[model samples]
Target: MANYYIVGLSTIIGLTILSLLYDSFDMDMYNCGSTLRNLVVTAPHDTTREFSSKNVTFDIAGKQWKDVIVLVHIQKTGGSNFGRHLKANLMLEKPCVCQRGSKVCNCSRLGSEKEQWLFSEHSVGWACGLHADWTEMINCVPSMLDKFENARQKRRYFYVTMLREPFARFLSEWQHVKRGATWFSSLHMCDGHVPTKKELPLCYKDASWAGVSLDEFLSCPFNLATNRQTRMLADLTKVGCYSSLSDAETKVKMLESAKENLRRFAFFGLTENQVDTQLLFEDTFKLKFMEDFIQRNDTNAASIKQEDLTVEQIQRIYDVNAEDFLLYDYARDLFKERVSAMRARRKRRIPS
Candidate 1:
């Protein structure tokens, strides 16, 4: 980040007031502040890995690389932490999230991506809260595969994302947007984060007081209008949720299952697993800096208004986030399977 240093003239606190007054939209609030003009001159990604006493080179574009893996930040799943970490770690070009029409596209500016890879010194780690479209995996993968094969000699990038339990995410969303008069979080008009990560709990909370719930809404067929409804649900299943937290039988099973799910994340370096952040960075990225980079609380502080939810309210959350539930569950299973495979490989090397 030498090329991307803070212009420490004066006006340190001066900038803070300007940002608050403007109510800026920033993906990485801590590091980049409110500046959208992210600049870093990357010159040839040349990094070697030492895994198991082996030295391997990281190739990209024409040198060492694969498709840029971006984490679509859905509201509060460690978005600021993730964005700052990504920019600080990865060498990305002009990564931009274009909001065209209703869909939000998280991508690098055209042409400049190649320049960043060709001339830049490290890998470009692009991340943002601009909502992720995994279907991009369907289209973008094909276009990038050929280039990736030549550079990194790989056809895929490690598309990584961390998710939270749906109901929790929903509660958080509802509480967060309720106080603000922002129209984006309104019922008729929704923004990027709502559809991708959190559920439309603003209307739910308001509606629930009037006996309206997502379960009632989701009872409708998941069509284009309801697609966001289902997608919102998909993120919750990663942590598992059912109708009642009062279900002693199901609660015990789910709590244990959640722990099991988190246990495997150690293999992926995902913080959602409650693994040591340093272990996560060192293991996955194969590098370490600012070992104590952040205090343990990746999410917001306790004093912040949280989405106060009843156990029954959770099912409404699940119903809304159903789509994210599918995606989260699929990814979670894949993550677990990969962890198993890694363990098996280690076992094989254990002198058997």
Candidate 2:
């Protein structure tokens, strides 16, 4: 009887694994274009209110939060400038092992599970504002964290993130990399051939796209080009690298997770709306972002105008990042909804 029971249990486990694998690969067959409408329902746009006061009270995520903000800094999205401004003016700066040690520390990737956990936890505990990747958020303060039973237990933990249109971000990142931007050296390194068993994130491994022309870059692989924003938003444990997203089940799971995370964020902004983002963030947090701050304005040098890219290149970028475009569309809609709600509240407060 015991032998039969064990066999039954094993069979059930095997079936479950098989089901998951099947779901992961099944995504390849579906047409994303047909499903995009279902994915991103358009929201009514709202006019933003101009802020004049510093002491205004605001509520976000259906709750009032005055302190604590976690900024998920997506790469090449003007997140650095935002994070720096936040720390220099409003919030306590967090210590990144990479920042403290070198321009790029392989500690997170090279270290053991325990080491990574310690780094992540310490970074979170030490900062009034965290500007790390989404992976750190998942590792240190998972729902399973012993110190907190739920997100409410850490009521101060407010999440925020900024996103760019995928194609624009990709182009900017590519140009930046081509210029051999020192900060992006590690990421650039991974554009080459990736070993299947490498411990680093898959983005840090694939070399097929490195040192290639625009056409060649597209042909080599689409790992980094595809759904990076979504991957960053999803829990890292489930979404390791872009390669993992190729599995239909994993892709679905990751997309669902990203959507859920987006819902949880108190403030989601777009790079295209930098001024509005700054104002909204300040008004929401009751903290000022740099308006008079002198930043290195290398806009013309860094930017590759959309018109410069040929139709074929543009299409390739769009085709590779279909999932990201979908997520981005959803994020834009969500941002509009949140902004509209805020605008409505402010309008109601004003007396005629």
Candidate 3:
């Protein structure tokens, strides 16, 4: 009778264990996302007023800020992709809460709202600006430093631009806005997605395509290689391009100095080749972007019109951008080294 009682008890325990295993194994899939989303509601922060999908400037400010930065956009060197990446990944991580501010991206009313929703975010502490006009940027530099310095705390990192080799970047620009066939939102200026003289950006329309013939225009972009030094000095004068450069080397040196300072600031992305305009950011930004990223911006290969230009015309186009390539080549290596140093510094600060 005792043996029978022991066997019954063991059988009951085995059945109970089997029932729990069957119930838990039925479906492994789960909606963990809903649970996570609920956490945001309880965190005491509001996402509605704080984040604007339409606010491009906020796209710059809301990201993981590093004291002060200026995204010196070079026409088609993946600036949009970088901008998108900044907003979704970095800014979402570190949002702005300070209400009283004067920077372009930083607004008074929005900052207050952001502060209320600050509980909603874990923003990295710092403010940076994006820029286009070199002269305006230079003038603002001292003040930018002042703004960061006046605060008791400041971020150690800062930077400005990421330019590709001129030739490659120029092609990327050409490919980028081919109008209707691809996903360039700014392409709205064109009809059927083709860049007419009217729809082109001012930089491209005014200088690059002005005097060139269609055959020449399609074969290669002209005048894209106006040296950085020449442009910087030329922009500062009351008359842009009217300001005479006293010495080319002096201008070059000044740019070099500025770049060195902003070396910490500027994160340059390059086009790998002049003709194809492939990306150089994988190694530089230390992040590998997916194809949909490239497909959205440059899709020229999809519906390309073949032009059998002579080797000479191709060389001329190449020559026009040779200076940019050289500059990019030199800068890329230095920038990589600088980036490595930054990573090293960060690793040292990490607690063992």
The lDDT of model 3 is 0.35
lDDT of 3 by residue, 266-352 (tens): 344443332112223332333333332343425433233225445444455444433343345456675555446556655887999
Residue pairs whose backbone atoms clash in candidate 2: 23-249, 24-247, 24-248, 24-249, 25-248, 191-206, 191-207, 192-206, 192-207, 193-207
In the range 140-185, model 2's lDDT, one tens digit per residue, is: 4433333432233332344678898776677766665455442322
lDDT to native, each model: 0.34, 0.49, 0.35
Could you estimate the TM-score for every candidate? 0.42, 0.58, 0.44
lDDT minimum window of 10 residues, candidate 2:
41-50
User: Which has the greatest lDDT?
Assistant: 2
lDDT of 2: 0.49
Error of 3 at 345 (Å): 5.6
TM-score of 2: 0.58
